[model samples]
Structure formats: structure tokens, C-alpha cells
Target chain A: MTAATASAARADDPLAIDVHGLVKSFDGKVVVDDFSLAIPEGKIFGFLGPNGSGKTTTLRMLCGLLTPDSGEGTCLGLDLRDEAPLIKRQTGYMTQKFSLYEDLTIKENLDFVARLYEMDRRTERVEESLKHLGLYARRDQQTGTLSGGWKQRLALAACTLHEPRLLLLDEPTAGVDPNARREFWDEIHALAETGITVLVSTHYMDEAERCHEIVYLAYGKLLAKGTIANIIDNTALYTWRANGKNADRLASKLRGCDGVEMAVAFGADLHVSGTDEAALEAAIAPYRHEEGIEWFRHKPTLEDVFIHLTAGSKDNFS
Target chain B: MKRPFSITRLSAMLLKEFNHMRRDRTTMGMMVVIPLMQLILFGFAINTDPKALPTAIYSADTSEYTRDFTAALVNTGYFHIVKETRSQEHLDEMLTRGQVQFAIFIPENFTRRLIKGERPQILVEADATDPVATGSAISALNAIKPRVMTRDLKGITMANPPAPPAFDVVVHRRYNPENITQYNIVPGLMGVVLTMTLVMITGLAVTRERERGTMENLLAMPVRPMEVMLGKILPYVLVGYIQATIILMAAAFLFRVPVEGSLTMLSGATILFMIANLGVGFTFSTVAQNQLQAVQMTFFFFLPSVLLSGFMFPFRGMPVWAQAIGEILPLTHFLRIARGILLKGSHFADIQADLLALVAFVIVSTGIAMARYRQTLD
Candidate 1:
């Protein structure tokens, strides 16, 4: 399709990224295979996957940092292939690694990016970004000397300084602390409220829960995609929360039992889950009468569903 | 208790380092390739006492005596007469263009003066820009008079065989009359210094970005390939100029090397040569995966440029195949232009061919670098 027509079709959809059949491979190994998704504008979309599950690859393709082997799509209402430069102009991408110049100071890095985008009042924009990211005091410090959390904050500030319509973050909070991650999510929500679409990939379950919608990928294939409650409700897995003294120790005993797909310990409680309701009941029936133990039926959590989904998918390398 | 030096631990470290070394194929290949290249280049290609030096003859007299004299000089295996020009201007043009190293000028009354024992003069003008190149050939010419006249005077009726001939061989070392080596070397060093710095500094530019993980971010931005290339090279142009200025100052004051030609023209030509080297470095950066590979590639290019660019040795001294290879190097052309302008007081028109060569190198190298630069990670 022509770039204009492809873009025209998505104009009415209010989708920032509307790509389909996106396939990318490196050295004969398919990193992102037959991937397709449409993210509406101003939505916080989370991508959860194991390592090397094509999360970064898909994020790169969405932001025009990489081209798919055989795909026809549009990013920011522009053709992914022909109008990548246009897409890149309007989209902000924060890489999985800290990709800014380490030798440059925080202010210099921001000013460089600002000048690249040819923003008016570059010094003001750099100052505002530094102040907003709480990096004003450290503006003169080299980026290489910053802590991981501060570096992540600076990277985010640099990416959003131009106020791009869409932001594609690849594992943005991978090595960050919990407090910094929370602050980052708060900023993400604040940006979303200002009508910025964000597509972020992460391995954190809590982060996945914060997204308006999430997609679980495994081995270059999408396993499940929906809102947190929707995905949990869609799964047939029944979970029984067992709480007692030493209830977590019963995880190994309950594992490998008939119809018990996963029996994982969550701190002091044991969550036994399975797809078949009758078989799952029979396996947990013997534990129901255990001394001082209380077994109660509960809804499956997002982590439970993720583990179950990943367990079902075959490991490509192995 | 753990021992301080355990064989198992040492073996494990060795195995890990071996694995790391094996994984980087470029470094491993460079290790083997650099040594082999140096052996071939330094061993077989380099020749200090250059043979078969290109000679141009401007003889007013083509008599049997001149023929025998020319034959005797050629028999020395030092001078190879490539062109016999009638006009003195044509002979001068050949020397200025570096087409010929030696010019043999025989006077009009050479045969008659010799027959009358009038001590006729045979002027031999050698391009002494490179003193080492002409040193041996000119010394060889001193022995040629006896050999030629012994044959030519045999047919003549001379009562006594004069210990010395009735002829004079006046050797004129043009451009550099003193035959000072520093005069040639100092100017050539400017070209070599600029080449080494410009190529290496710009060569590491893109590779540093890639190695530091910043290339992904740079590519993801709205910048164009040409923008990146120009941005990376422009600052280095100023750096190259500073380096050129320092070298030129040192050559003039420290070594007392004469800047006979226009300093303005030298500055202009040095800029073009710097851009050419920067272009070559940019091309190398695009091909290299990491900074180490980039450095190795720079050294690989630098080795041939220094050895074959007539910087250390004479241009006319090497064989035809080696000269052909040297002709392709930008430094080879720059060395000639630099020496010609600084020492010979040559004008822009004189070094036009070498100037055009540097421009061509810049264009081709920049084109290759732009083509090879990746705008996307794919």
C-alpha cells in the first residue's frame, strides 16, 4: 500500500502504532515472527516476556530503529518502511541499555538531543528537562558517573524532552530500584494523561499490572494479550491458596501431582493452580484435611497465568 | 584451605580468555594479517638504492659520441632513459611533474669540442628533491665518461691517452642544490603526520559510538547519514589544520626547510589531503564492528601509506608493480605535492595532478563510507 493510504486508513482509528505481520530475523534466527499489534493513542501498553523473547526486537521495529524482514505496517500513522524517518521524528525510543554519550554531562546530552531535533530555546528545554527529572544539581556531572537509577531517569528525560507523540521503551526499568521504578511509572502515567501513547517492555509482573493492557510473549510468539483482569479471567486455570504454618513447604509435594500445572510459593502461602477443575480438586483434596491448614479457592493472579503460559510454550533454543 | 596459585583456576582463566579471543574473529584475523602484510611490504617492496630511475634526455647533439655516452650511462643499470625530449621546457616539465628523476642535457658542440680537446661540457641536471634517489645514480655517472670515451676515442687519432677526458661533466642538483636530506624529509613529514592523525581520529569516531551502545540511540533519532558523517568529520578538519600548522611551523623554523611556494596554496592542499584521510578513516569505521577493529584497520592502512608513499624511500626506486600500488595511495600524491610546493617553489599549476588525485580519493572514500554506514540496526 502507498504510505499515504496506509496512513489514511489509521487516521480514524486513533492508533499510534498499527502494525501487522511484523517478522524480523537475525542470522537465520527469527527474533520477532508474525508479530502484529495495534496500540491506540494515549494508552500505556506493557510487553512482558522472558529474556530473548523478541520484546526488544518488536519495540525496535515499532520505533523505526529496526526494519522487519517481511512486514507491512504503519507507526505514528506513517508507513513503517518508507516513512521511517518521519516516524522517528515524532517517536521517542529509550533503549534497553543506556545509549546516551557517557562522556557528556547531563546538560550536554540533553542539549545535544534538543539540537538534533532542532528545538527552539534549546538551553531552556535542557534546563527544564534537568529540573523536571531532579537532575538539576547533577547537570554538570558526566553520565558515566551517575547511578543506574539516575541514569535511567536521565534517559527518560532525554527521550521525552521533545514531547514526542509516542514513546517506545525497551526494558526501561530493568536494573532500577523499586522506588525509582515507581517514580518512573508515575511519570509514564502523567505523560499518558497528557495524551502520549507508551509501549514499554518489562519482566516485572507489577509493572505489567500497571499497564492498561499487556501482551505476554514467549519464544518469538505471543501467548496472551489483554487487560490484567481480562487475561486472568480468560485463563481456565483454577487456583487454590493454601495458608498455614509451613504452607510454602508443601510446594514441592504438590508439584508433579496429577493435573497440578504449577504449585508455586508466594511468601507464606502456597498457590496450587491447574487448568482442569475436577483433577485440580482431587489433587488438593488430600491437602484439604491437613492439620492447621486452610485451603481456599481464589482467582488466578497475572504472575500465575504468565508462568502457566510460558511453561506451555516450547523453548526454541533447548 | 585454598591454595594461592591453583592450576585449575589458572586453567579456567586461560580458557575464558581463549574463548573471548576466539569469539572476536576480526581481532584474531588482524593478528595474523598484520604480521604477514608487514613481512611482505617491508621485506620485498622496500628498496633504498632505487634502480632503473626514470631519465629524460635533452640532447642538442645526437652524434655518435652522444650515442655512445648515452649507451654507457644506460649500461650502468641506474638510469633508464624513458623519454627523449627535444625542447628544454619539455624536459623541465617532466622533472616538475615527477615523471622523470634525471635529465641528461648534451651541449651542441659536444663532439667537436671533444675532437679539438676543448673540454666540452655535458650538463646533467638531476631532480635533487629526493637526494637519496639520485645519490647513487649521479655517482655512477662519474665513472661513465672514462668508459664512453675509451670506446669513442679509440677511432680518433690521439697521441696520448689523457688520464682525464677533454670533456667536462657538470652535474647540477636542481631545486635542492645543497642535497640536504632534511629539506626533503621535513616537508614529507607534514603529510605523514596529518595522514596518521586524521585517519585514526576519524576512524574511531563511529566505532566508538557502536562500541559504547550509543549507536542504537543515534540511529533511532531523526539524524541523517550525511549529517552524522559531516558531524563526525568537521571538527577533525580543524584539528587536522592545527596539526598541519604546527608541522609547517616546525619545518620552517626548526628544520629551516624553505617554503618557496605559496603558504596559502599549501594550506588549501593540506585541507584537501586531510579530508581524504578522514574519508578513508570514516570508511574503515563503517567496516569495523568495534573500536579495536577500527584501530587495527587504521594501522593496516597506515602501514602501506608510510612505507609506499615515498615518505621514507624514493618513489622511483621501487619496481613497477610496487610503484603501481603506491600510485593508488593518497599520501603518495600528497608527498609529491608537499615536496614540490615547499622545496621546488612549484605553483598550483605544477601540483595540479596530485591535487586532483587527493580530491578523487576524498570523493571515492566518502562515497564508500556513506554507502556502508547503517541507518538502522538491521
Candidate 2:
């Protein structure tokens, strides 16, 4: 939804975050433009963007870890500017980097975060978190000794120990294996089912599909925001998949064509997509009857939409 | 296949290292600032042969000869008459309070005795807590008897062509009669050691977290700036006490340095001093971006404290401006407290001013640290 309409979301669904015209900059360069978002409570909201696209900056702003250069908003019904401390108390933010102390044991890290929140029954909570993280047996091991997957999991557990109502995860599973990543997503969904709103930023398309709604940012500007189907449908992008000998090699030749917005090789098949259906059909007419080459009309995937959105925006840093 | 050292490769490495140095502006500034500071300190601030020491004079006689003798004392360039007391008790208070380094007491009927050829004696008491501060001034007193009252003593047989001295000048060195340097150095070492370690260690507290990428996590939590500052610095207070305990033990057992005052008072003062230093370190951590910058800032402060705080040099020897700078440092006041209690057995009333100064330092530095501390990553 547009920033203007964000406040008008249905009354029954309370917005965990409702921000408008949020702008932030660093060193005279804008890192996040006039971005706005509204995520209803209990929904897992996905944030998609490329490197240096202001995803982390926006997440930091939402959780009160950073102040917007100029903006007005509320997270969990508290003013983002005036009540940041109160907002921070209710919000759990997992940074993109592994920020927990490496020298501390897994149990110690969780205990420290618990103490900061002044949570009661800290011992019981820490033990439960250790078990939930599947690190009960090795809770005393130094966090630095754990692999990337375990470290990420421990960070998540530490942030959620306070049982915050809203969770802002910035690339929480960026460097994890497939199985660990899936497990992490399952935990996120489980938290959301308990009525905790989550705003997670990730580049993984599979992870994006797991969210109830998604927002795409490029060059510090919000390009798209909606459900998975709504975002893809909003692009109105047409696609064709070519499966034949040297199909993937056609990406280089088809990239700059007028009708082809993105010509990406998906394994053995080449998926070419564009907004202009007629131009795309005419552009691929020559290859339609080529020897040993077969082309079929294909539905646009979420990856296609993501690539199309990122390819259209300018880089703010440049 | 390559030579022992390729000139091009060497030049490349040199350029890279030079760029690294250029980019770290704090280190670059420290490199230039430290030597320049030392030069200014040694060339202008430090003086071994202290002159114009604050001295108090009390005399019962108002005769012209008495005025002439006092004038002769000022002419020696060693004694600066700061206060002229009416009674001997006032002179004693001035010396005990460290308000004056030297106090000269003229006995009753001093001019009558001079004419009678009695050779009456005048008492000159020196606060010998710091022997170096009083050594040369005592020697300067010896030269005074020869030239003083030559015209006033004329027509008196005692002054006929300067026959013997008119009167005896009896010098009394109080606090440390033997002029042992260890008494001064050993006590002053406590303040120096605490200042060095506490400032440097707590200086790295916040910046290390920032460098290790844990500061973001800490800041993102529900912790306040004061909470983080106190949490980081309070533990170092205990560390400072341990260091102080070791130094005190060494002073008592190894160096034979006497603790003349209440040990409880000294312990309390040491804690206040540590908090003041830790506050300064925490302030530095907030201003520095990384651990290296924090350390550089620490030395920038630490060098001046060591030099200008009068731990190594006579405090009154420096120019007024340098002493004024020294007055602002916590170490300067701490040195006074340490030396006063250890040497003079000073009570709370004697060292209360320095204690108040350290309390003020703790409040002001911690205030600035909290004000400069960024609550958000803005």
C-alpha cells in the first residue's frame, strides 16, 4: 500500500508498524529515501533489496536503533522519534551481522540479553531458549566456536528472549545452509502465529514467499509492497521459457533487447521477461521455430519480479 | 626469480603504509602533538630549581632593620612573601595546610638583641615533604645573613666591618627531616599508577565493543547511556583498588614509605580518584570511533597528566599558566591528597579542597561523557 493509505489499513488489523515519509542519510548521501510501510500484527512481512539498497538502514530505523533524518512514524503504537526507548523495549531487532559477543558462551549471551530487558525468571527463560535453539547440550561453548548457522540461531534466540511483540530481522539467515535456513523460517512463522509481528529483510526468494506480505526497495526508494501474488501481478510482466541446447547462452544476447527486461538462466532453461507482452512475443518470434529449440509461455515467478524491480531503479551511491 | 627487494614493490608497500597512517588522523595528530607537548612542558613548565616559593613572615619588631631583612629575603629571588602573619600560630597553620612552603618566625626583641650583641636566633621552618622544593630555598637563606642589615648594623660593634653574623638563622625542616626522595616518589607513584592504568583500561571499554560489532547489539537493547557507562566503568573501579592496594603494600613494605594518616580516608580518596579517571576514560571512549583511537586519546590526556600534574616536577616551580593547567587535572589534586596524607598525616580538613576537586572532576567528566554519549546510532 502507498504511504498515504498505510494509515487507512482496516481497523480490525492493528498495524505493528505505520511509518510515512521516512528519510535517512549518511555523509550527505541519502541511504533511505522517503520510504513508508505498514505491517499488521501477526503477519510476517518480508523486506527485499540488493546490496546497499537501504534495507538494513530502514530496519534500523523501524526498531529505533537509528533515528530518521526526517520522518514521522510509530512502531508498536509508540512514536518512533519521541518514544524510541519505549519502542525499543517492545521491539526485538536482529542485526544483519553477528553482533552477539563471541567470547561469551551461548547461555551467557542469552542471559545478558535477558538481563538487559529486566526479564523475570531469567534462568528458566535462558534454559528454554537454549533448548529451543537446539544448543542445550553445548550452551556453555563459546559462540565464536559455533558455525555460521548456529551463530545465527543463537542471535535470534537472544533477541527474542524478552518475548517482544514485534521482531525486525535484517538478513537473519543470510549465510546459513538450506536446512538451517528453512528451520529458521519455520521458527519465524511459529513466532508470527503467536501474534508477534515480524518485519524481516532477506535476498532469498524462497524466504520472501514465506512472508504474508513483501516490500521491495531499490536505491533507498520503495518500489513495490504487497502480498507475493500481488507484487508479481502488479508488475504485469510477461515471460517465456526456452528449453533447448545452449538455452542458457541466449541470456547474454537477449539482455539488452527492447522487450526483454531480464534474461536470466534458471538452470537448463532461460527465462526472459518484460512488461510489454506484444513486444516480448515479437522479440522471441525468431527463436520460436529454431532447430532443436522449444519455447513455451511461462508464468512470471517472484524472482522475475524482484530482478525486474531492482533492474529498473537507480543506485543512490553511484 | 626476484631480487632481494624490488624498488617498485618496496615503494608500493611504503605507499600503502603511509596511506594507512594518513587515514588514521588521531594517530597522526597524536604523533605530532606528543613531542610538541613534551617540548613545551620541559622547556617552559618544568623547573628543577624552584624560585619564589610561597613563604610567610611573622615578626614582633617593626623596626627598619626588620623591614630591611625581609626586603633582603625577597631580593634573594627564592622567597616570595605571600602572607605576613601577626602570630606564630598563623604561620604554623599556613605551613600545615601547605599554603606556604616556608615560614620565617622572628623572635621577640630581635632588634634589641642585635644592638646588645646577643646574636639572637630567628627560626625558619621549611615544609620538607618535597625536599627538592625546599633544598635550594634553604641555601638561599644562608646568603641572606651576609648582605642583610649591613647599613642598619652600622655603628654597632657587631657590624664593625661585618664582625661575625648579627644573628643566627636556625633552619627547621619539618615532615621529612632527612630529605629522603623515596618518601616523595613512593607516595606520588600511587596516583601515577592509578591514573595510567585506569584511564587506559577503561578508555578501551566502549570502543572495543564498537570495534567487535557488539556495540550495535548493546545499543539496540533497552539499556541507557548511563547504564552502559557505569556498567563498563564500575568494574574497573575494583581493578583500580587492587592496583592501589598493591602500590600501597609496596610503599609500606618494600620502600618503607610511611602512611601517617587514616588508611580508611586514603582508601576513600583513592576510590574517588579512580572514578574521576574512569569517567575521563569513558568520555574518551564515547568520542573515539575505534579501540586504537581510544588508546591514542588516552595518551593525549595521559601525557599531560604525567608532565603537568607535578608528579615528576615541583608544582610551584612552573609558571602560573602551567600550574593553572595542572590545577585542572585530577592527577594534580590527587598527588596533593596522596602526598598530604602520607607525609603530613593530614586530616580531612587539610586535604578537603583536593577531595572536593576530585569529586568535581568525577561529576564534570561523567556529565560530559553522558552528554556526548550517543543513545542512538545517529
Candidate 3:
């Protein structure tokens, strides 16, 4: 399915990443299967998937860190295959792991990155980046000695020192504290507002809710893509909430019943959802009259829709 | 109630180690292949008693007695006549250039002097640069006198009854007249030391980046393959030069090994040899997966170099196939060049062929390394 057409937001905006049928394999095992996307400029695009769902592979191909086995695409208006070096020069890619030299100081790491791009006014830019990340006092500290949050900030500063047109972040906020993650997102949003397009992959549901749009992948396939509300609405799933004493206990019993695709506990309540409305209502009919229990119709959440989509897809490895 | 070491835990650790060994196939292959290679090399290739050393004849007198004397020298199985020249300069040139191990010069009237029992002195000049190569060959030279003394002349009869020596064998051991082993070893040590350190050091260069997970970051940058290779290799080349200089200084001052040839020429040859070895190290780094494997590859190359390159044994003593393998190693050629300059005082013309071989090695190894250097993480 073409995920670009599914999203109606900013339909007329120019695309920063326009890829089609981006298939990639390792040792004949397809890691990404016929993936395609068209993300507009200056948008915070979230890539959502489970483990081994081709999110990292797709991000690597977009940033020219890896070549697709067979694909045709343009990243920042340049051919990905023929103009990789050009794409690399204009693209800022933050790898999943911290890839900067650990032996170098924070300021030195930034300076080295600036040198690699052959950027002008290197010392001034490196100083500004060190100050921007709040690492000015510790600019001479070794990168290996930084905390997880500081390392992530330093990596972001290093990749963006050249002022790239596009930024590809692979789980940029992973292993970071909630406060630091919020600050990181703030910086990302700040960058996006300045007309830099961002494509970030993450597993945090709250992080997913912050994106202007999201694309969900499973089994190397694009299962859904759109705004969070659009995806939740498109799922057409019916949900009911049961809030009372021991409402969480009913979840295990409701699960595996016909028409009950998911029965998950949220604190003192149970959220039961399914795509078939009538069968779902019928499945919970017998529990509605229970003593000391209250039931109410509910709106399906973004996490509920993702869980439903994941259950419908087959695991290719199995 | 835990025991100091449980049998089950010990067995589990043993099994885990065995599994790791099985997974690392290169280490396992080396464990088996290196011993077998050493056995074949030591058992079949090495010969302490070298024979058939190339000899040239410069006979001013061509009589039946001189012909008999040359035949006697060949029959000792230590000398093989490779050339026959008339000029005295050509005979000395062959010995200096190491083309012939021994030069036999017979003065005029050798037959008449021997018949009159005048005890003619027949000079035999041997290149004693590698004393081991000429040790048994010189011993075989002594046996020729007794064997030829008993041989009867076809037409001429001895005036005196062979009581005095018919002809005296004047064995002149050249280059290293006293056969000082240090003279051969100290110069060749320059080549051996550079090979040991330079190859292993640069071999770890790229592999360290890869093992540390920095190569991916390096590849994502705009740097080209040649740029990365040279950046990694050039610094180590300077280190090699420093090492060569130290060894040369020690040889001159401590060992008293004469630097007969021009220092500029030797330095030029040393630079070429160092680049060739660094090229080899860089190529090995590209092929190996990690630092351990890179070091193993260096050992595999260095062992053959030390053994077959005539550092520990005579180069000519090895079998034909082993010599062919040694010929491919840069250390073998560099040894010849170093000894040629420091010991024999050979000029550029004498060592040009070895220099050309070193040039070819530098080109081919560097070309292969550059070709194998991955531009992308693919």
C-alpha cells in the first residue's frame, strides 16, 4: 500500500523523501519488503514498528548509509543511487548506537565532523554547537565519559553542524530520561520549525503521538500510515471500557473470545477492542450486567490501533 | 554449601570455550595449518650442508692438468661450474655481485709447474657473506687436492715423485674473510626488524577501527578509499623509517658492520622496502575481520619470511619450491640489498634487480589493498 496517499495532511507540500518500492535484503532474507514513502518537507515524521520491523533498515537506506537491493528514490531532490555522496553531504544521520569517536573530546568530535563536511568557520561552528548542547563547560571532556542524554545531544549537534536539509534519527531518545527526552523532542520540533525535515523512528507511544504523521510497519511491510487520529479512525475498531473493582481481572477472560482482538488493562479499567462491532458487542454482552461493574463506550487510542494492526499481520520469519 | 569449583560448572565452561573455538574458523584453521607448514618447511626445505654452489672459472692455462683440476672440483658435489671467463675483472665481478659463490683463477703454466713439482698456487675466491652457505663448499674444496694428486697425467710424467704438493689451493674467503657471522646477521637484521614491526602495526590499523565500530561512521563521511588508506598507512611508514635508521646506526657503531655503499642509496632502498611491507600490512588489515586475525595473518607471513628468506638459514639451501616462495617475500630481496651494500660494497647496478622486485611488490600490494578497501559499508 502507498502510505503517502493515505495521509491527507499537507498534501500539496513538496516531498523531502520520496521513495518507492524500497526493497532491501540481507543474505536473501528480505528485511524491508516493497516499502514506499513520501514525506513532506519540514514535517516531524515518526516511524513506528516492532523489533526487526525494518525501521532501521529503511532509515539507513534513506540517509544513503546503505543501498537498496532494488529501489528508486530521491532524497532531498537527489537520486539515492547515483547521487549518494551528494545526499550524504546534505543529510544528517544519527545512528542507533553512539558512533562518534570515544577517544575524542566533545568539542573535538564536533570539530572533526565539521572538518569532514569541509564546513567554513569550523572553530566558530564547533564552539556554538558545544554551547548549544549545554556542553561548553565540559567541551574538553571525552565523549566516552558523557552520560546517555549528553551523548545523544552531542550526536545530534555533530550531525547537524553542517545545517543539513534532512535529519534521520534512529531511536534518538532511547535510554534517555523522560525529562531529557522531552527536551530532545523540543529541540527536534525547534529544528523542524526552521524548515528542516525530520524522520525519526521510535517505540514510545507518547513520542509517536507527537509526530505530525506516523507510518507503522510489520513483517517488513507498511501496514498503516497517517496522523494518529486518522489511523485510529481508519482502523474502524469498536472499543468499550470497564471501570470498577477487579475490572482488570476480566481482561484475561475476555481475551481469546470470539471478536475480542485485544483486552488490555489500563490501571483500574479494561479496554476491549475489535474491528467487528457487532461481534465485539456480543462478546461483552454477558459481562455487562455484572454486579459492581460499569461499562462505557470508548474512543480507540493510537496504541490500541497499533496492537490491532500488528495482530492482523503474519510474522515472515515464523 | 557451594564447592570451590563444581564439576558441572567446569564442564560447562569447557563446553563454552570449545563452542567458541568451533565458531572461529580462522583460528581453528591456523592452529592446524601452522604446525603442518612448519613441519614441511623444516623437514624438507632446510639444508645446513648446502651444495652445488655456482662457480666460475678463469683459466689462463688450458692444459690437461687444469681440465682435470676443474673436473675434480665439480665432482666434489659442492661446486657447479656456471660460467667460464678469461678476464680477471669479470671473475671478481661475479663474486661481488653474488652471481657465483666461488671464482677459480688458474695462473699460466699450471701444468708445467705441477709436473716439475713447483707447487703452483691456484687461487679460489669464495663469497663468504653467508658463511654457512660456503662452509661445507670450502671444506669440499680441500678434498679436491688429495683426489687430484692421485690422478695420473696422460702424457707428462712427474719429475719428482709427488712428495711435495703438486699444486697449493689458496682459498680466499672474500667479503667476510674471518667468516664473522655478525657481518651477515647485523645487516639482514635491518630487513627482519622492519618486517616484524611495520607489518604487524599497520595490520592493526583498519581492523581496530572496524572492531571499535568507528568504520561505519568513517564510511558515512565523504572521505575516499585512497584517502583513508594513505591516512592510515603513511604515519606507520615514518615509523618504519625511524626503525630502519636506528638499526643502521646500531650496525655502524656497535656491530662495526661496514657501510661500504652510499648511504643515500641504502635509504632509498629502505624506503621502498618499507612501503612494500606497509602495503602488505594494509592489505592484510582489509582481509582480516579483527585485530586477532590480523595478527595471525602477520605471523603467517613473518614466519616464512624469517625462515625461508635466509635470515635463519641459507637462501640457496632451501629446496626449489621453498626458494620460489622466499623470492616472493620482500624481506628476501631486501636482505640481499642490505648485505650487498653493507658487506660486499655493491653499487646500484649490482642490486638493481632486487630493487625492481621491491618496486613491483609495492605496486601490486598497494593496488590490491586499495582495490579491497571498501568505500561503503556494503
Residue range A23-57, candidate 3, lDDT tens digits: 99999989999888888899999999888999988
Show the colliding residue pairs in model 2. none
Candidate 1 CAPRI-style tier = incorrect
Q: Could you give candidate 3's per-residue lDDT for residues B1-378 as a string of tens digits? A: 212233332332233223334444674454344433433343345555577989999999988788888988989888999999999999999999989999999999987887776778899999988887898888778767756755654245644545644566666669988555567777777787778777877788678778887777667666566656666666656666766776677678866878898889999999999999989999999999999999999999999999999988889999999999999999999999999999888899999999999999999999999899876666
Full ranking by DockQ: 1, 2, 3
Give the poorly placed runs of model 2, Cα more than 4 Å off: A1-9, A315-318, B1-174
Model 3 chain A: lowest-lDDT 10 consecutive positions: A1-10
Better of 1 and 3 by lDDT: 3
DockQ for model 2 equals 0.21
Report, for every candidate in turn, its global Cα lDDT versus the true structure: 0.81, 0.81, 0.82
Error of 2 at B149 (Å): 29
Q: What is the TM-score of chain A alone in each candidate?
A: 0.93, 0.94, 0.96
lDDT of 2 by residue, A152-263 (tens): 8888888888899999999999889999999999999999999999999998999998988888888898988888777766778899999998888888988888898889
Candidate 1 docks with a DockQ of 0.23
Give the count of colliding residue pairs in each prediction: 0, 0, 0
Q: Write the per-residue lDDT of candidate 2 for residues B217-311, one digit (tens) a residue.
A: 88787776756776667666766786777667767876677889988999999999999999999899888998899889988988889899988
Q: What's each prediction's TM-score? A: 0.75, 0.75, 0.75
DockQ winner, 1 or 3: 1
The 10-residue segment with the lowest total lDDT in model 3 chain B: B1-10
